[model samples]
Target: MVARYLVSPHGGRRAHPDISSALRAAAARRRPARIEIAPGRYEETLTVRGEVELTAAEGPGSVVVGRTRGSALDSFGSVRVHGLTLVGREADAVGCHTGTLTLDHSEIRAHGGVALHARPHTSVTLRDSVLAHGRALFTGGTGLVERCRFTDAADNAVAVLEGARVSVRNSRIEDSRIHGLRVSDAHAEVIGCELTGTGKAALMADARARLTVADCVITAVHAEGIMFIEQSRGTVDHTRVTGARHGIGAASGADPVVRGCVLTDCRDTGINVQTEARGRFEDCQVLNSGNIAVFSTDGGAPEVHGCRVVGGNVGVAVIGGARGRFTHLVVEDLTNTALRVFDEAGAAFAHVRVERCSSGLEVRGNGGTTAEVSDAVFRDVEMAAVAIGGQSRVTLKDVTADGGVLGFGVADEAQLRVTDSTVTAVSGAGAGALGSGRLIARNLTVTGSGSLGVYGTGSAYVDLARSEFTDCATAGASFDEEAGGQVVDCAVNGTRGVAVAGNGRVDTVRLRTSLKVVRHAEKPAGPPPQIINIFNGPVFNGPVRDIQVAWGNENVVQNRGENVRNENENEADAEADTGADAETGTDAETDTDTDTDTEGNGSRS
Candidate 1:
């Protein structure tokens, strides 16, 4: 049997005048006790040491327990408080120390301290309650907070520290001065919750904390919606973050896995991974980001897969010696480059598609930067589909670029190797090498170019083999202004202009069908242009011999045998140097001007 006691402010029959007298009488009993209080104000602190239940004779908001200092209610054993309002001015409203405390349908408010505090070895359950200030769970404190409201917190709404385990479900934490939920060196699970209007990040996990958040909405935060730092690890799935500074941030070696999340209208980057952090984002959508959709810097190596980024300034950026692997990514309506890798960074992209962007992929650095793109498609890009500069090296295989201003733009001593790629419907040259850049293309095809199909200028070099150029408005292959290279076993057909034209040295061997070389009249003071054509065409095998032509003041055509025909007017000073080998030549001139663009060079922003 349980002992029952009634407490009333006014003395009555068999009724205690105050709660202290009733609790004193119940303490003498050997059984559990129940204290029923009338609807009035109780201005005293209480401590419970045995099994007890405190109830209001009426319902919630009918009883008020107010204190000026210290906790209004402290529990050392099993205690239950229902339908009562506990308010404290300078201390915690309710505290549980080495005991179990259950609060249901109650209101706990603190003016200058925590609203609810659970010390080590304590278990607290807050259901359908409201916390005005904050709640803290220290080491070894376990709790369940369900269907609760945490509002106007002086600090973080809920803080779990020192290995505490807590679960918050179906709760609303809003208007927090700091983070809505902070976990340090602990484990927390937040499900089906709403965290809004926070001063800082909505959820922050640091000091190697482990967090699992699912089906949550975090919006209108001042900082990152969710942040993981200091080697913390977590999994956030099916979460939506809107109107935050940054949607998610991981730094200082933190490695979190975020999947199936939507981040929209972020003030900055949707996902920021920095400081050697290696996070993985899968099947996520970032829309209308103010800046880059995903940014990884400072040695951060993030893997983004199956993600869609729409309406951002830049889709993904990897710089500051960081590396990233982005696969199956679709980026659209970006104002800048779809993917940018710089500052000695390295990146690999496969099965990626970029559409309606200013530029497709850019790889630039002082040195030691590399990028590989394979099985990628670039459509409707405003600038070059692939731009490489600043001594960076890039390779493209099995890639297709359509409806771009330039297919590939290489500059500033950069090296680009393209194999098994196709460039079509480009407004500028299909591939251009400028400012001492080097290009090596094999088995490549370029069609429907407004300018030359392949061009090398400004002391650049291009080695083309087994390539095909068709429907080019300008010459198929051009090397101008001291640029020299070799074109072997290539076919140039359906060109509106000549097949080859320039003032640079070119060695053409076994070119398909007929070949036309046009030399301009005005040439810079340099070595004379030379062309060594060694042709033994089985298709046109009738009486054509090797020809060597060196240009000196006029168009030149030299025939070694009587059967060969001169397609251009033979000049007096032109020479037929048959001893010159088509496979060997001196190095081209070194150009110091890095900003000069060729006639069909792509524009750089």
Candidate 2:
């Protein structure tokens, strides 16, 4: 099937001294030639066999192949090289081993080692090519680079060694100093690529490699955006990795699978699996990081779903022999310990959530481990939202911690179970620091706490039911220094509510709630002149608990028409209880202010 044959570098005749001796005498006259090569310097080395074809009379920088010393092209059968602009090369500019070598829209620049060196069963194809100044010792071999663009490559711009299987699509491998994409004992398929200006690892795999990266966009890398060493196996999807120090680096028996990725501005860890590594991250988004965003070690098994670990120094860092499982996760800004379970690790958290954090969770010195935190939500934590040290076994259900200073801190025999939770606005000091414990909280709600909401230090057995504690400054429920706790249908608001000092055993707590006192207007006796409630409780019906004030004489003279005749006799005593539900208590009124008390008058004191 002789379809065409036309070889020229200028005139013909065993082809002249120009055009690489007339394209090496029309490709040694095996006859299927298409060697064009016009416009410029062509130093030498253009070895080809039959079925030859080398074009570029005008495309890339106008057909220039000026390799002053070594290889320009050492292709085999069925070869096709278009739009050429291959300059200085001392080693490999193009060295296909067998057949089918096709490079389109080319420009292979200055090289000491490799620009392209396909060996075993070669079928190299590079499109829209541009492999810049590459310095190498087997830099790029088994190739298939589409929409190619590899800039300033000093070492390892692409090296798919050992039983190679490489395929990079929509490429843009930027300025590399060391490793940009080096798959060892290879198998790679990086799609929609953009391995940014890297100095260290933009992509690297060792021994048992099998990488499958998709929709990629890896940013400025100095260390690792994707690295799997030893027994490697990687898979990153819908990726986006920002300035990296470490975005995903699995060591040893690696198994990485991160989906829907976004690891932002990292300096240390966004995802690091060490030693016998294993990983799985889905729907990920890890923001501003200085340290750990997700780390695991030796016997690892990392599994995180619907993840988001915001501004971090330590968001999710599990140490050696790590094991984890997190669902619907959200670990917020952490300066230290957003969720850190060190050493002999084990973790399992569901519906996990945590907000503005300092220490949302920290179970250090873990052994055997067991943390089954459920339906979690911890907000604005500054100190302790949860801190269990050592021998793990923490089980918290329907957990919710708000504005925390301390929510749960169990030190020694860390074994806890908190059900249906709601710990709101816990202020200042240690609010609930139960060490050496066993707590079972039901329908709990500890609001505006200052000192202790529930503090049992040491040997304990707390079983709180229908709990509710409001605006506390000092003690709400404190089983001080150990032992017993069993409270049902509880409710305590403010100063020294329930304080069982030391050896404890408290039972009866059923206070039916009924107190609405609002009567204060003395004033002119000194300087206490404001008492404004305006509309407190029962108005029509008679559950009127208070508002008592009957002081006679001594310059006591009220104006404003005697304060509307004392609220029209308390609204006719709330219409005598309004028995038939006649919109009961519909006209409440209680106001006694001589002048002003700002904040626009909706004040509660």
Instruction: Report the number of backbone clashes for model 2.
Output: 3
| Index of the highest-TM-score prediction | 1
How many Å off is the CA of 430 in candidate 1? Answer: 1.1
Per-candidate TM-score against the hidden true structure: 0.86, 0.42
Q: List the residue pairs that clash in candidate 1.
A: none
- The prediction achieving the highest lDDT against the true structure is 1
User: What lDDT score belongs to each candidate, Candidate 1 first?
Assistant: 0.79, 0.65
**What's the C-alpha lDDT at position 511 in model 1?**
64
How do the residues 1-605 of candidate 1 rate in per-residue lDDT, one tens digit apiece? 88889988987888888777787787778468899998898988887768888888898888888767777888878889988899877787788986899999999988888888889889899999999875554566998999999999998989999889999999999999998999999999999999999999999999999989999999999999999999999999999999999999999999999999999999999999999999999999999999889999999999999999999788988889998999999999988888888889999999999999988888888668989999999999876788787789999998889986678767778899999999999866688776678889998889998666887776778888999888876567766666668888887778365566555376777666343444431122323222321111000000011111110112224322222324563342233122212222222222121121112222332
Candidate 1 weakest lDDT stretch, 10 residues? 536-545
lDDT accuracy of residue 339 in candidate 1: 88
